[model samples]
Target: MEIRVLGIGCARCNELEKRVKDALAELGIAANVEHVTDLKEIAALGVLMTPGLVIDGKVASQGKVPSKDELKKLLGGGK
Candidate 1:
């Protein structure tokens, strides 16, 4: 799986990335996680807000940092 965190290096963005890792670890899932900081690229992804979360090329969330549990649910098909 591929997970991308889109942000411009803000604290929230960093936190989101960390939570993504934590979620992956908790779920015992391995994924290629990337942090995207380019404005143009983020815009291209249809994210007008920072701290966007993308899972497998699909936009999952944006504009805020979700909690670890929320992230896990999102990663786990909302279960």
Candidate 2:
């Protein structure tokens, strides 16, 4: 799976990326995590907020960092 974290290298953005990685690791999923800081690319996603999480080309979360559990759910985990 491909996961993209969109931000301008802010603290929140970095934290979100780390949380995402931890969540994926817990779920045992191998994903490619990328940080998108380019304005043009970020705008193309139509996100007006920083610290956005995009999973497989679809925007999953934005504005703030979500908890690991929330991320796992977003990744389609749990019973």
What TM-score fits each model? 0.94, 0.94
The true-structure Cα RMSD of candidate 2 reads: 2.1
After superposition, which runs of candidate 1 have C-alpha atoms over 4 Å from their true positions?
Answer: none
Model 2 spans with C-alpha error above 4 angstroms: 77-79
Find the 10 residues in a row with the least total lDDT in model 1: 70-79
For every model shown, the clashing-pair count is 0, 0
Model 1: C-alpha RMSD to truth? 1.6
- Looking at model 2, residue 35 earns an lDDT score of 97
Against the reference, the lDDT scores of all candidates come to: 0.92, 0.91
Which tens-of-lDDT digit does each residue in 1-79 have in candidate 2? 8899999999999999999999989998888899999999999998899999999888888898999999999986422
